[model samples]
Target: MLGTVEERVQSCPECGEEIRTDHRFVPWCAACDWNVDPGEPEEPGGRLEALRRRLAREHGERLLAEVTTDEALRPRRDAASVLALALASAVHGFTVALFVGGVLLVVLGWGGALPVLGALCLPIAWLLRPRFSRLPEDEQVLYRSDAPELFALIDEIGGAVGTTGVHAVAVNGETNASVSTYGLRRRRLLTIGLGLWEMLTAGQRIALLGHELGHYAGGDTRHGLVIGNALGSLRTWLYLLSRIESPTAPEAVLNAFYLLPRGAVLGAAMALDHLTLRATQRGEYLADSFAARCGSTEAAVGLMDALMVSGSADVTLLRESNALRGHRGAAGEAESGLWDRLAAHTESIPASEYERQRRRGALRGHSVDSTHPPTHLRRSRLLAVAALPAAVTVDAARGSAVRTELSGARKLVARRILNGG
Candidate 1:
């Protein structure tokens, strides 16, 4: 998902105002007291199951066909490639034009009526430029020499995928693994979730790493950076415009004139972004296929199942955070027991029932802004790939050593989380 569940916003059809409702099924607008169909409240599990069945009936056949057809599965870079270059050029050109135009207007002393207006606007654009700066590394723990095992695994996965190794690796508290770029250089950073590592088997772990590494091999991260920065610039520009304080009527009128064109430009950027969403989704499928090649189909499937099973990590963390209140130093110790608690909870649920829930969860689909395809769609695509030879198994000793290394990393992560870093 693009954001937290609580962060999901809905627009009221009647008022066209954003509404923050407690329940998704019952979207009630706080502004106009607008209610959407006011149907009987359905249990979360029942809703998920219904969604799963509905999606299967609607999109299952088409998804299966797309996955099975080799041509359909191929990643088409022509559109995304062109769009990325065009977007980068447009943003750079616009900024440069703003600065140059401002300088010329000031130097020529043209239009006393609009004296230095361009010069004044230039500073605003430059000030807002920081907001479009390259994404920073958000992980609390930066695992370089500290996590040699992970670096080695990343290198191995990079070799398997025929790409240069990652620049750095880090761990987070989430239940997902992702590859991202930082700064203008677009240096790669691979982030793995401690919770996900605790849940997956050795083969599944390999598959997960392979999936992330596949993004680099497929150029998804590079293209994504272009789109991401463009969107970021648009958002920052919008935010700066919105925050412009119009203390007087004249200032309000002036701000409105300034914002009007920028707003149109923002709208155009959004439309361009929408056009590339399909390419982003296809990149995900390509990555899945790459993972299937690196690891066996079984390993890829296992990784997907593990993802479904452990998707509740957010909820678990929330509960743990509450429980950790007033127990400051003991947070790391509390965290150490989380995996065991989760394992026990999983065991308490019957295997058949767990599978059913997992299948249902997969059908709920991802949020609109998510770049990855829905879990159900990805799972289907993996199933369509022809079976490959078994992946090489890690030796028991090596496996044990990797787990030991991960365990150490987990403690560090736990400490970081507890200390509120």
Candidate 2:
């Protein structure tokens, strides 16, 4: 255990204001935010950054206006959506054609018709085969039977929105949570990150789940079989033709030969991404609406606020994980207070800090990531919607049981973090 903590006063170099900082908390001028995010003082690439922000901000604003007026985020067969599907179909057809051609040539070659041609085509066809997502063989997964209380909550939330139910839940040590599909059946999988989950309120947790599961109801075109697989195939091609950062003489020749095809694939990928951009963004907003409906508007808004502060959570987690790893390095066994310390640190954060993070998000025109609308806009839209009480709730007893069920997952994740594997 450490000694009694005391507050320290320091002058803010930029704003020249006295700031009180504690060892337990990150110190920065609440007034000017000096020394906070020093490395990322500004967004990189002056003019390009400005243009990107300007364009993104304008696009976000326009989308906000459209949604405000429409507010109907159902799957629509719009022109762009149709075009994307057509492109995806064409891409898939090309792959199938390659496969058929390769197999036919191989058969002919075996029959002593065209052996060399058959041999070359067979390799090409095999390489161009349709790729499918597979569940990671090593990643840990929790079935409903393993955690009934948690699955109950998840089921309730799914019913509140509109999902059959997730196939399983996977826990990770990252600062984000997401839902994914696996296999030909497209079995739903929910992965909740401890770093973000620990920082949330019970209600915010519901909102997070609602938002994720909402994607199923929201018709995320990018995740559809046609568009998604096509995008995957294009990515595979790009990967195969990708240039080496440093190349020897023969490798240089290969790179030069691959350049044109690489450029074409890159351009196609960009275009496909653009085609699905609006639909995906719409899906995200609708998901937020689902969050509001299931977890209440306030909880949904709070979840968005929590997302903005995830960077701070990430930084603190890095510090804590490094310290924890160092402790393990020095001792035979180390006590794990990783989650406890993270929760405490987040709880200790002042409202002022969250407000500052929100302001920074607005200035940066930040979305959850590059794929969604700006955070501020999302919050605004959530507020604009009619308020509703939570459709699903986890009482203290159930919540406790849920946590207990997650104990094993916590150990696995903590091991993953400290070991840095």
Maximum-lDDT candidate? 2
lDDT for predicted candidate 2 compared with the true structure: 0.76
Candidate 2's displacement at residue 355, Å, is 2.0
Model 1 stretches astray by more than 4 angstroms: 1-64, 71-75, 106-115, 127-144, 221-225, 243-263, 326-333, 343-349, 352-363, 366-370, 390-392, 418-421
lDDT tens readout by residue for model 2, 245-332? 8899999999999999888877777667777777787778889988988989899999998887777677766665566654667422
Show model 2 residue runs off by greater than 4 Å: 1-37, 41-58, 110-118, 243-259, 325-336, 366-368
Worst 10 residues of 1 by lDDT: 39-48
Each prediction's TM-score versus the true structure: 0.73, 0.84
Per-residue CA lDDT of candidate 1, range 1-421, in tens? 1123343467889899986543312355556655522433343343223433343345444644765687335555676568666875687567677777777877777878444697696786685353323343565444557667667767877887768777777777778888877666767888888777666667777788888888887767235655555555666666565635645888778687877776676665555555555556667777777677667778888777767666455555556666777877777568777666655544443343344434454434442124456666677778866766434356688787776766765776766555554
The whole-model lDDT of each prediction reads 0.63, 0.76
User: Considering only N, C-alpha and C atoms within 3 Å, which residue pairs clash in candidate 1?
Assistant: none
